[model samples]
Target: MDLEKPQADRQRDPEVREPEGCLVVAIRLPVRIIALVVVLPVRMLWDALVVVGRIVRDTVLRPFGRALAWLGKALFVWPLVALWRWVLVPVGRALGWLVKWLVVVPAVWLYRHVLTPAGHATAWVARGIRAALTWIYERLLTPVGHGFRWLTRYLVVVPVVWVYRWVLAPAGRAVAWTVYWTGRVLFVLPVLAVWRWILVPTGRVLAVVGREVWTALGHAWRVTGHLSLAVGRFLGTLFRWVFVEPVRWVYRTVLTPVGHAVRDAVLRPVTEAGRAVGRATRRALTSVRESVRQARYDVRRMLFGEPRERVAMARREPAGGETRTLEKRVRREVSPPTRG
Candidate 1:
C-alpha cells in the first residue's frame, strides 16, 4: 500500500505541480487555429506566385534569354573565335617564331657560350675566398668562440640558475597560489554559481516555451495544408461542372453533326469540282509545254544548222555486207599457196 501511494503521488506531481504542461495545453488549440488562419492565405499566395514565376520563366524569359545568347554568340563570340583561329593564331605563331630566333636563341647562346665561362670563373674565386674563410674560422675563431662560451656559462648561466632555483621560484609559487584563491573566490565561484543556479533554470523555462511554440506552428502548417487541398478540390470540381461540361456537351451534341453535314453536302461537291478543274488545267499545261518545246526546237534548228550526227568508226565492212540477199551477189577470191 505504501509503494502504491508513492507511485500515485509521483504521477500526480507531474500533472499538478508542473503548471507549464497545463499552460501549454490551454494555449495550444487557439494558437494553432490562429496560425492556420494566418498561414493559409499566405501559403496560397506563395503557391500562386510560384506558378506565375514558372510560367513567365518558361514562356518569356527562357526564349528571350536564348535569343540574347544566340545574338551574343553570333555578333561577338563567333567573330572573336574566327579571328583567333584564322588571323590571330597565325600572327601569334609568327611572333613566337621571331622571338625564338631573335631573343630566345641569342639568350641561350649567350648563356651557354659567355655566361657559363664567366660563372665558372666567378665560382672559382668564390671557392678560394671560402676556403680562406673556413681556415680562419677553424683555426682562430673556433678557440675564441669556445672561450666566450665557457665564461658565459660560469658568470651568467650559473648565477641565473642559482637565483631561479633559490629565490625566484619560491616567490613565484607563492604569488601563483595567492592568485588562484583570489580568482576562484572573486570570479570563478560566483560565475559558476550564477550559471548553475540562475541562468540554467531560466534557460530551461524559455526552452520549454520555445519548443511548445514551434510544435504549435508545425501542427498549424499541416492542418492548413489539408484545408487548402480540400478547398482546391472543391474549386476544381465546381469549375468542371460549370464550364467544361457545357462546352463538351454543346460540341458533342450540336457542332459535331453540323460539321459533318456541312462536310458531306457542301464541301465534297466543291472539292470534286476543284479537283476536276485542276486536272483539266494540268492537261492544258502539258499541251502548251509540248508546243513551246517544239517551237524552241524549230528556232534552234533555224538559228544553227542541223546538228551533225555522230558517225561510228569500224574496223571491218558493215555487218550487212556479210548477209547476202537475193538482190546482192557474193564475191570469191583466190590466194597463192605458201612456199615450203
Candidate 2:
C-alpha cells in the first residue's frame, strides 16, 4: 500500500470533488473575455477617478492635515512637555536646593553653634552648684557631724560599754560562781555520796548475776543448736529417700518414655505439617506479590506509553563524537574571519 496516496485520499473528502482541468479553463476563459469586453472601460474610468482623488488628497488635503497636526503640536503638546521639562522640573529642583540652604543649613548651624554651647554652659553651671554643695558638706557639715559623733561615743556609748565589760560583768560572774559552788557543795556532793554507796553496790551484784546467766544461756544454746541440727539433717535425709527419689525415678523411667512416644506419634508430625503449610503459604504469597508488581508495571507502561528503561539506556551512551562536531560548528560560526 502507498502511504502517501492513502493520506491524500483521506484528506480529500468525498462530498467535495475538484473540477476537471478542462472544465476549469473553459469557465475561466469566458469570464476573462466578458471582463475584457464589457467591464474594461468602466474599470478604466473608475481607475481614473481614483487617481484624481488620490492626487487631490496628496496635494491639497494632505498638506492641510500636516499643517493642522503641526499647529496642534505647537500649541498644546510642545508647550506642556517643555513646561514640565524646563520649568516645573528645574523649579522644583531649585526650590528643594534653596530650602536645604535656607532652612536646613541655618537650623543645623544654630543647633551646632548656639544650642550646643548653651547646653554645655548650663551643664557647667550645674556642676559648679554640685561642687559648691560638696564643699559645704565637707568643710562645715562633715566636721560638725564628726564632732557630734565623737562626743556621743565618748560620753554615752563608751561609758556604757566599759561599765558592762568591767563592773557589771565581773559582778555577775562572781554571783554566778558563788551560787554554782554553793549548790554543788550543798546538793551534788550528798547525791554523789549516796549513789557511790548504794547504787554502785547494787549495780555490781546485778553485773555478776547477768554474767552468770549469760554464760549459762550460751551453754544451753550450744547444746540445743547441735541437737536441732542433727534432727534437721535426719529429717531431710528421710524425706529425700521417702519422696524425692521415688518421684525422680518415676519421672525418669515412665513419664520420659511416654513423653517421647507422644512426641514421635503426634507432636512431631503436627509440627512438620504446620511448617510445610507455612512454607507453602509464604511461597504463594510471594508469587502473588510478584504478579501484582508485574501487573502494576504493565499498567503504568500502557498508560504513559514510554519505557523509562529504554530512555535511560539511550542517555547512558557516550556522545563524545557529537559533542566534538557541535563544538567545531560553534567555533566556525562564532570565530572571526581570517585574513585571506
Candidate 3:
C-alpha cells in the first residue's frame, strides 16, 4: 500500500527467480506428457530387448555348448574311457583267470587227481582199518570188555551170594530161633502157665462151685457156659470194657480236640507272624538292592573314569618292579596227614 510496486510480472511467470547471488534455481513443470510419449515406451522396449537378448543368447549357446561337449567327449573322453575299459576289463578278467589258475584250478586238479586217488586209497585203507578194528575188537577189546563185565558181575554177584550165605543164612537161623522163642514166650509158655496154674484149678474150682450153684440155681446153670470158658469170657469182657474202651474214648474225645484247638489258635498266629516278617524282610531286601544299585553307580563314576589314561600310565610303568619286603621261611614235617 505504500511504496512497493506490485509484483504482477513475477506472479504471471512460471519459473521462480533464485535468491540473490544464488547460483542454482529450481523450477516445477508438467513433464507428464514427455514421460508418457518418450521415456516409458523406450524403457519398456529396452527391458524387452535385454530379455530377448538373454533368451537368444541362452538359446543359441545351449546347443553349441552341448555339441562342443559332445565333440570333446567323442574326441578325448570316450576313447580314453573305452581304452580304460578295454584295458581294465581284460586285466581284471586275466587277473581273475590267473587267480583261478593259481588257486582254484590247481585245487580242483589236485582234488581230481591227487585227492581223488588219495581218497580211494583212503577208502581201501579204511576198509583194511575196519577189518583190523574188527579183529582187535574180537581179539583184545572184546575179551577185555568181557573180562571187565565178568569181574563186575563177579564183584557184585559173588558178594551178594556171600552175603546171602554168610550173613542172611545165619541171620535167618537166628531169626527163626528168636521167633520160636518169642512164640513160646508169648503164647505157648503163657498158655502152659495158665493151664497149669490158673485154668485147671480154676476149671476144677468152677466145676465144684457150678455144681453147688447148679444145685442151688439149677435153671441158671443151663443158661451159663462151661466153667472155664465162662470164667475167661467174663474176665476178657471186663478188661476190654473197663480199660481199653475208656482209654480209646478219652483219647478220641478230649486229646484230639484239644490238640487241634491249640494248633489252630497258637501255631496259626505264629505262622502268620512268620509270613509277615518274611514279607517285611523281602521289602527291606528290595530297598537294600535299590540302595546298592545307586551306590554302585556312584562308586563306578568315582573310581572307573579315565580308563584310557590309567591304561596309558600303566603301559609306561614297569611290571613287578617293587622290592620284596619279607624274608623267606620254610617248615618241614615228617608225618603223613590224617584225614577224616
Best TM-score among the predictions, by candidate number: 1
Per-candidate local distance difference test: 0.85, 0.78, 0.71
lDDT (tens digit, per residue) of candidate 2 on 70-120: 999999999999999999999999999999999999999999999999999
Q: TM-score for each prediction?
A: 0.65, 0.28, 0.22
User: Candidate 1: lDDT over CA atoms?
Assistant: 0.85
Q: Give the TM-score ranking, best first.
A: 1, 2, 3
Model 1 clash pairs?
A: none
Estimate, for each residue in 1-340, the C-alpha lDDT of model 1 and write its tens digit.
0111266686767555344466666666666667777888876666668778999999999999999999999999999999999999999999999999999999999999999999999999999999999999999999999999999999999999999999999999999999999999999999999999999999987776777677667776776677777877788899999999999999999999999999999999999999999999999999999999999999999999799998978844438548644444332323455699
Q: What shift in Å separates residue 53 of candidate 2 from its native position after superposition?
A: 99
lDDT score of residue 131 within candidate 1: 100
Model 1 segments beyond 4 Å from truth? Answer: 1-34, 244-340
Model number with the top lDDT: 1
Candidates 2 and 3, the one with greater lDDT: 2
lDDT of 3: 0.71
Off by over 4 Å in 3: 1-235, 306-340
